[model samples]
Target: MKKIILTIIYILTLSGCGLEQGSYLVGWWNGDIPTKLSDKEEKIWDICREKTKYLPKNTEEEKEKADMELNNCLHEKGFWD
Candidate 1:
């Protein structure tokens, strides 16, 4: 039931497993949990967005590098790491 599902989410959230799990719980719960970004995360978000914008269009090499950079950024930020 709903209570059981919520209890499982609570346990996983506390265990600090990974962001995907945490994101789903918060997102699925419609922001039941706080999703505030820290100052550092805000800065990284800006950088990543800017970098994504400047990636060369119609260039395979540039696209690959951009993809790698984005992945690296996310990993560094501990999202998909």
Candidate 2:
């Protein structure tokens, strides 16, 4: 059935599920990836804030970058790992 085929494809895709940086320690490299995160994902959020602290003031681009930065900063120095 079409449904069965779609399900198989979905499973295959998720089988390789991974965040941007590929791993947590490597998180800082991408600035928009979260790898090896734990239950305390909040900790990584804080670290992202610190890493992007020096970025420019309020702006769409800055906000977008911050969001992406958070994706990768979660496991750097916070309790997320």
Candidate 3:
């Protein structure tokens, strides 16, 4: 019975799984400074990169968005330029 209960808990946990949408964008926003990213942000970036591999190639607009995000991240990191 204990084993069954443990299995049920595990299954429940797994069922809550969901990917971070905009994670890559967030990562791109959070500058590339080694100390800038929290552990969670880094993980989100990795997941975004992996997931975006299946997305259609980025358009110019997408590229612009990425640049904007990167700039935001840099600004947050105290970069003025």
Candidate 4:
């Protein structure tokens, strides 16, 4: 009985059966983060590197929004002709 219960618990934990969508586990599993920069991306990265160092003190949500805006700007100007 103990082995059976432990096995069931282990499977449930591994499956993330009851986890919320916004949990950190979900974010990590989604892998939306960029890990490397292409040449073009590097150019945009250089252009934005200074801005990244100077982000203003703000709430977490506001900072995330600012980062998203910066990423959108980089995408628009870097890849779009």
Indicate the TM-score of model 1: 0.37
Segments in model 2 whose C-alpha atoms lie over 4 Å from true places: 1-43, 75-81
Model 4 steric clash pairs: none
Which digits, one per residue and each the tens of the lDDT, describe model 1 over residues 36-76? Answer: 78777777777776867677757888888888888777667
Candidate 3: which stretches are off by over 4 Å? 1-57
Clashes per prediction? 0, 3, 1, 0
Return the lDDT, model 3, position 13.
81
For candidate 4, lDDT tens digit of each residue in 1-81?
A: 999999999998888877878777777789854356778877877776665647663898878877876787677676443
Candidate 2 residue lDDT tens string, 8-34: 999978865764445663556557554
lDDT head-to-head 1 vs 2, winner: 1
Report the candidate with higher TM-score, 1 versus 2.
Answer: 1
> Quick one: best TM-score, which candidate?
4
lDDT of 1 at 33: 69
Q: For every candidate structure, what is the RMSD over all alpha carbons to the true structure, in angstroms?
A: 10.8, 10.4, 12.5, 5.8
Rank order (by TM-score, best first):
4, 1, 2, 3
Give me the runs in candidate 4 sitting further than 4 Å from their true place.
11-28, 31-35, 79-81
lDDT of model 1, residue 8: 97
- Per-candidate TM-scores read 0.37, 0.32, 0.29, 0.45
lDDT of 1: 0.74
Alpha carbon lDDT of residue 51, candidate 3?
45
